[model samples]
Each structure stands twice: as structure tokens, then as C-alpha cells.
Target: MEQKFKRNIGWLQGSAMTIGAVLGSGVLVLPSLAANMAGPVSLISWGLMGVLTIPLVIVLAKLSTLYPSAGGIAAYARQAFGERAGRITGCLFLGTVPFGAPICALIGAYYLGHFFLLDAGGVTIIALGMLIIAVLANYRGIRFSGNVQALVVIGIAAALLASIIAAWPMVRKESFYPFAPNGWVPVGTVMTVLFWAFVGWEMICHLAEEFEHAKRDIKRSLCISLVVVNLLYLGLAYVTIGTGVYLEQENLTSLTGLLESGWGRLAGSIVALLGVAACYATIHTYMAGFSRLVYSEARAGNFPKWFGRLHVTYGTPYRVLIVLGPFSMMVLLTGLLLQLDMSILIQFPGSIFIALYIIAMAAGIKLLPPKSISYYCAWLACIVCIIIYLFSGWIGVYPPLLAGASWLFSRQRIRVKNGAISG
Candidate 1:
């Protein structure tokens, strides 16, 4: 018998999950990266990206209400375009978690090293330790993890809000001069990069079926999460650039530097701890979503049945969580061993997510009834996704290549099965 998930999540948990997932290490690092890429004009990029996400959010919210499932985006793709498209969507999603989890974990770990004066070895150990903790939290089930996420999101929001308030008084109007020093072209470039910050909302979709009132609560959560995320992102961007700390320091350390400049070392340390909590929230949500995705695929006969098994006592996908934990650690360890920059790993998943967003938006258009509000929103969202993909440069190419390979393998398997049946 196939096991099922309990709908124990309410609007509060759903919103917290969305906010926690969306408010990851990006808040700590992206402002400086955006400033560097497009100068203070990246502020415009931040606003633009946030506005563009509205259509996508509306479309996803509508889809969730209509077809709520643990598979989330993959299920929508499957319904619109058949099994192959759905499997590809699921594969791409599952592919991202191993890389995304470590990338987020390392961000938290890196900042912790700065706070504690830890060496690379210490940081690597901390990263692995954090991954294990996240896996354990998730293995207990969504109800447990969801409660943790609510508190985590509150801490992160408070930290970011405090930093913004402290920095606001120090803002210089002079920093606005020469806003587009790199020209308007880089705004588009930075928009693609900043798109990483907007990715968590889609991730929350995977848990739609777990909502107490999927139709009402999912849409309500989406709206609230988006508003909260955009306010924090814009506030952080303004403070990072307006205070001019980002202009003076390395991108990775700029957020810490900004907080320290205003509120001293203690403030920086507190923010770093909050950053670690934020990263864990993201990893926890991703693990939960990815396990369900794997379970969804397995239930559909796309993956090995072992992955579909749930723990009898905990009622969680323990097998998938157990497998994912070590796999994520391996990625983190390999990166540490190779001395690879975290940015490379981060960009790989960001690109794949862009591709997934495109697929989801198209699926929304096809699956929803035509001439409706959602239909138009899907069209606009699809266009926005394409524009971002075009600006994503070489970073955008890898996902399609991966999806094509997956498609080919899925097709070959289908042919073999047909041949066996015919024989």
C-alpha cells in the first residue's frame, strides 16, 4: 500500500515555510553581489525582479489550489505534458537538492568561521555537522520541521530588520550618484543572479498537499511570503548600498561588515548565528520537499520502490532523508577537498531552478482553463522566465542539457519496456 501525508499544516506553517525557504543565505550575500554586478543600480534590479515574480506567484498559487500534491511542480508538469515531462521536472528538482543543500550550508558555515576565527578544516566540519542536524530535523516529519521553521523565520526576519534599522540612519544620499556606473546592461545580468533570492516560493509548492486548506491557505501564504521577502530584500539592498559598506569590502563579507560598522562585533556575531539558522531552515525545507519528490516519483513507478517507503513510527520518508543526508555531505566534502568556491555550486542550482520555473509556468498555461486570469498570468510569467534565462548566460545552458539527457534516458526506457511487452 502507498503511504499518504497528513494535512497538518495551516496557513501559519505554510507561510513560515515559504518565508524560511526564500530567506536563505542570499540575504547575507546577494546584496553585495548585486551591487558589485550593477552598482547601486542593482537596487532597480531587485525591485524589478520582485515585481516580475508576482505573475509567477499568482500562477503557482492557482496551480496549487487546482492540483495540490506532494509532487508539487512536477505533478503539474506531469498533468500538462505527460509522464516524461513530469519525471524530468522531478529529476531536475531532485538533482538540485544535493548541490543546493551544501551550497546553503557552506554559506552559513563560512560566516560562522569568520565569527569564530575557525580554519577551513573547522568550517568543513561545521558544514557537515549542520547538514546532519538538518536531516535529523526533517526525518522527524514536516510537523516537527514546520514548527522549527516558524521560529527560524522569525529570528531571521528580526535579524535582517534590525540590521536595516541600524544602517538606515547612516545612509548617504551621495551613494546614489553614478548609480549605473556599469551601464544598464549589467542590470539584466544582475537580475538573473538575484533571481536566486526569489526561488523559495516555488519550493513551498511541493508541500501544498500537506496544507490543512490547500486551496485557501496556499494562496494566502504565497501573498504574505512574497510581501515579506520583498520588503527584507529591498531593505537589505538599500542598506548594503546606501551605507556604502558593500562598495568597500568583498561581496561575501559585506553584510557582516555592514552590521559590524553600525552595531559592533556583537551585532555581527548575532547576525552570523541567525544566518546559520536561516540556512538550516532552507536545508530543512529542501530536504522535506525533495524527499516527498522522490517518494512521489517512486510511487509513480519512476524511481526504485525503496525510496517510496515511509517510517512506520515517524510517518516520514526516512529512507530518502537518510540517502540525501550523506549525498549532500559528499558534495560539501568534495567541494572542501577540491577547494572550490561556493559561488560555482550555488550558480549551478540557480540555473536549474530557472529552467524549472519556465517549465512550471508553461505547465500552468496548458493545464489551466484558457481565457482566465491565471492563463494570462502564466503567459506573463513564462515571458519573464525566458527573459531571465536569456540573461543567465552560460549559467542557463546546463539545465536544458541535463533535462535533455534525462528525457533521452526516459524515452529509451519506455522503448525497452514496449519491446519487452511486445515480445
Candidate 2:
């Protein structure tokens, strides 16, 4: 018999897990990105994004109650539509994980090195070191690593809340004077950038197989998680705008420049450190849940059956961990070596991910038989997403569409046997 992962993570651990993954470097750099893209109206767009995401969260949570499994969105999609549709959802969901994990790792490393005032390539080396440790810990299994995750979540949240509050007095009210200075084009562009800030909320339900009493807890956890996250997000946005409007109406570039101006040469370094920590936490959690999903896929025969194999002592997928670690390191090096702007590189992928999510949620709600009419709210969610995507512009929207399309094509190969889609 195949060994079962102990269903040990509960509501609190589960919530921490999800929030930790989503809340990462997003909070740190958002102020800068919002400044660059939306001016002040990104707040409005944010509210829209929050409202739209709620329904999909509800659907995922509801599914957790009825069909709690590691396949997550994949399983939800399968049940609602059919085997091929479900497989498409699964492939899309899993495809992004490997790509994202490594990049996030390298990004966090860049920050780590910066915090220590390290020289060129210092960030890359530190990031790789941290990532290796993280990979080893994850391969050791959740039971051993749960406490560390909990601490990272708590520490990161506390620091962010404190930073936002601490920066409150710096607001200049007039900063938002020329809201949308570049006009609607940038606002839409930033909306796509901000979408990355909100991407990982569904990871909890995807890891549902590990939860205890998943039905009741999943609902409680998602609600609590989103509320906390939203508040933090809004608080940061307010600080950025209010502070900017106070500091003579400059755009994000100037505003960020101002963040360090009062302090001189060492200016903004503190915030920079915070940004790196946030990235580390976010990247760490994303990889953990992502690896779990991959391991689960292997078990279900959706991946190379070999991927399902586990380490003898830790009961983790040692091979997958080994493969993914170096991949993220490579991306990190490419980004830093090229001196790519963080905002441009990171924002585009986020926009693409959001587009993919809109489809996944649509597939889940439409394909599944509705338990209630309110469940139809998912279509509203999709409409909201489309608006955000359009506002974000064609550049931001097309990549994820192509990615999800690729995943859809991969499903065509799965053999249909006895009314079941078999990989």
C-alpha cells in the first residue's frame, strides 16, 4: 500500500500556511508598484479584486467540505466539468509552480544580500544558500517544519503591520493630487502587477488532504486569512498614497527615493530589508504547497508516475525538491545578472497568473453542479477578473492565457477509458 501523508495540519496551521505563502514580498514592494502604476485608484481596483476573489474562495472552501483532496482546483474542476476539463485545470495549476518557485527564491536572496550590504552576486549566493536550507527542511516533512512556518508568518505579519503604522505620520495628503498621472493605461497595468499580491490564497484548499476537519475549518481559515491580508494590503496602500500626497506629489520613483531621503545614503534600507524578509516568507510557503501538489499529482498518475516517489526517512519527494531548487537559483541569477527591474519582471507573471485563475474558477463553478444559486456568483467573479485583465493590458494578460492553453493541450493525451479520463 502507498503510504498516506498524515492528515495533521489543522485550521490554524492551514491558515498560517496559506497566508504565509500569499503575504510575502508583495506587501513590501506593493507601495512602490502602486505608486508606479495606479497612483491612488489602485485602492479601488484592489477593492474590486478582493470582492471578486471572495466567491472563488467560497467555492474552494465549499469544495473542501465535500471533496477534500490534494488535487485541489484540479479535483474541483474535474467534479464540476468532466475528466478532461479537470485535468486541464490541474495541469495549469501545477505548471506554474515549478517556474514560480525558483524565481521567488532568487528574489528573496537578492534582498537578503542587500540587507547585509553584500557586494554584487552576494544576494544570489545568499538566496541559493537560504533556498537549499528551505528545500532540505521541506523534504523533512511538514510535521517537523510546521513551527518554523508559523513563526515566519507571524514575524512577517507583525513587521508589515508595524511598518505601515510606523509610516502613517509621514503622509502628505497632496501626494495623490495627480492621481493616474499617466492616465488609465498605467492604472490597468498596475492592477495586473497587484494581482500577484493576491495569488496564493487558494493554496490552502489545494493542500486540503492534510487538514483535520477540513469542512468547518477551511471556511473559517479562508475568511480569517483574507480579512487579515486585505487590511494589511489596504494599510500599506494608504501609507504609500497618503505619504506621497504629503511629500509634494511625486510618482513612485520619487516617493521611493523619498523613503530614504530624510535618512540620507542609508535611506530606505530598512524597508528594503523588510521587503526581502517578506519575499523569503512568501516564496518559502509557495514552494511548500506547490511541492505538495506535485507529489499529489504523481500519486494520481497525472504526472510521471516516478514523481510520486518519496524519500525513505522523511517521506517527502526528495527528487522533486532537488530538481526545483537549482531551477529557481538559475532564474534568480538571470534576473540579477541582467539587472532586470523587479516590478517589470514580477508584475507580468502575476497578471498572467490572474488570467489563468479566472478561467480555473470559471471552470470550477460552471462545470460543477451548483449546490446553490449563490454559487453562480463565480461568473461575476470571472467578469470582475476580465475587467482587471483588460485594465492590466494585453501584455500582462496574454502569457497566462498561453500557459493555461498549454496545460489544456497536455490533457488531450490522457486516454478516455470506461467513461473516465486516465493519464
Candidate 3:
């Protein structure tokens, strides 16, 4: 018999995991990227994206409360749209792992390189090492990952707080002068990019079944995490922009540059290490969530039965981890070897995530009672998702293509199986 996951998580751990996942590479890099696109006005984009996510979060929270499942968003899709939609949602969410996890690892690797003065070869080696550690930590079980995530979130929060304090004195009012030099149009463009930072909230839904009190605790955790994440993100953007570091050099390690400008190299190095910790937290949570998604699909017969197997003692989805870890590493290696722009890798997953969000919100509208607050929120969220998708440009095209392809392939497989059974 397959062992079941233990519901060992409480509100604190759940909130920590959500916040940790949200605070990852985005906080470390997106502000600089957004600034390069929109100047100080990008700070408004940060705040705007944060506010826009509230409706989406509310809808997801309601869905999780009503129908908690290991499959999370995929389960919601199944309830609302039946088996095919569910399978496609599962595939899209799972597809994110190949591109998304490597992006997180690369973010950490870039920072590690800055901190250690390592070359490309050294960064690749360190990134691969971090990926291994994340895989092992997740294989141990959710409880173990939850604990590590709690500590990591604390470290990241503290580091950001320190960076804010250190940079407080250097903040100048003049930084706001040429704020919209690129005008409001770029703000919309940058909002699409900043939306990447807000993707983690929905990922936490996959762990809803693992929470001790899924109904009350998941809601509380997401609410608390939302507040914390918004404050930290806005604060980080304020300091990064005020210090004018992003304007000077729009590199991946711009947060470190911001800190170094205010304090020195030592402070910059400490923050870089914290960025590495943030990456681990995000990767750990995503691995845990993605593995459960695979386990849920397997159990539903969407994937091979082997993927549903659990570790006898740990109750973790060991098979999924075994398969996914190496696959992600291969993708990471390909990106590194080919010297692909990290932005392409990052933006690719963001598109899929937005598509997933649209589906989840649509599911909420279908599942929840009509005219209820949850239903209304779902409607608003769907609109916001559509707007973001439009702003996402050509990158947005990939998710629909991926989904259509998966749907067609799945339908063909079903036809073949049905024919075999009839014969």
C-alpha cells in the first residue's frame, strides 16, 4: 500500500513556505529588470502587481478550502472542466518544472559567482550542486522541507530588512524626478515582468492537503504571506530604486550592487548568500509542489502508475523526484552550455503560470456558488489574468501552444486505449 502524507504543517510553516517561495529570485532581480524597462516608475508596477494578485489569491484560497487536494489547481480544473482540462493543467504545471527550476538555480548561481568571484565553469558546477541539495531535501519529506523553508524564509526576510535599513540613508528624493521618463506605457510592460514575482501563492495550493487544518490554516497562511511578501517587495524596490544602483548597471546581481553602494562589499556578499538561500527556498517548495502534482496525476491515471509510488518510510513522491531532478538538471545544462539568455527561460514559465492562473480562476467561477464573493473574485481574477497575458507579448503564445498540443496527444492516447479495450 502507498503511504499517505502526514498533515504536520500548521499556519506558521505554511505561511513561511508561501512567503519563501514568493521572495525568491524575483526580489533579488525583478526590480532591476523592471527599472531597466521603466525607471523609478517601475516601483509603481511592483505595487500594482501586488494589489492585482489579491483577487487571484482570494479565489485560490476559496478553491483550496472547498476542495483540498494534493493536485491543487489540476484538481480544481478536473472538477470544473473534466478529465481533459485537468490533464492539460497538470501537464502545463509540470512543464514549468523544466524551465522554472533551472531559472531559480541559475539565479542562485549568478549570485554565488558574484560572491565567490567564480567563472562560468564554477557557477555551473555550484548551480548543479544546489539542485542536488534541493532534490535530496525534498525527497526526505514535506515536513523536512517545511522546516528548512521556515528557517530560510527567516534568513531572507532578515537580509532584506537589513538591506533596507542600510540603504535608508542613501535614499534621495531626486530619484523620483524622472520617474516616468519612459511614460505609462512601459509601466504596463514592466508590470507583466513583475507579475513573475507573484506566482508562488498558487503553487502553495498543492500543499493544501498536507496542512493540518486545510480550511482555516491555508486561508490564514496565504493572507499573512500576501501581506509580508507585498511589504518586502515594495520595500526592496524602494531601496533598489532610491539608491540608483539599477539605473547604473542592469545586471542580474543588482540587489548586491544596491547593498554594496550603501554599505560595502561585505554587506553585498552577505545579501548574495541570502539570495542563494531565497533560491533554495523557492526551488524546494516548487519541487515539493510539482512532485505532488505528478503523484496526483498518476493516481488519476493521467500519468504512469509508477509515478504514484511513495517512499515507504518518508511518504514522499520519490519516483517523481527521481525523474524530475535529472530532467531539470539536463535543461539547466543545456541552457548554460548554449548560453541562452536567462530572461527567456524565466519569462517562458511566467507565461505558463499566467495561463494556469486563468484556468484556476475559471474553475473557481464554475465550482463556487454563483453571485457569491468567491465567484465575483474569480471573475475579477480572470480579467486581471487576461490583461497580464496580453501584456506578456509573444512569450504568452507558448502556453496555449503547449496546452493544445498536450490536449491533442492525450485525446489520441485515449482513443488508442479505448480501441484496445473494445478489441
- Angstrom error of the Cα, residue 316, model 1: value is 1.7
Q: Mind giving the per-residue lDDT tens digits that candidate 1 earns over 1-423? A: 668777888888889888888888888889998998888899999999999989999999999889887788899999999989999988888668889899888888877887889999898888888899889988887888888888888888988898899889989999978989989999888887888788877877888868888889999999999999999999999988899988788876787778886788677687679778888888878888888888888888888888988788777889999899999999998988898988776888888888888899999999988999989999999998888788777877789888888899899999999999999
lDDT of each structure?
A: 0.86, 0.66, 0.86
User: In model 2, what is the error at residue 396, expressed in angstroms?
Assistant: 6.6
Off by over 4 Å in 3: 1-3, 251-253
Misplaced by over 4 Å in model 1 are none
Clashes in model 3: which pairs? none
Query: Can you write out model 2's per-residue Cα lDDT over 190-268, one digit (the tens) per residue?
Result: 6656777788876776667766677777788888888888888887778877766323534323423544534455535
TM-score of each: 0.95, 0.82, 0.95
Locate the minimum summed-lDDT window of 10 residues in model 1. 262-271
Kindly give the number of clashing pairs for every candidate.
Answer: 0, 13, 0
lDDT of 1 at 218: 92
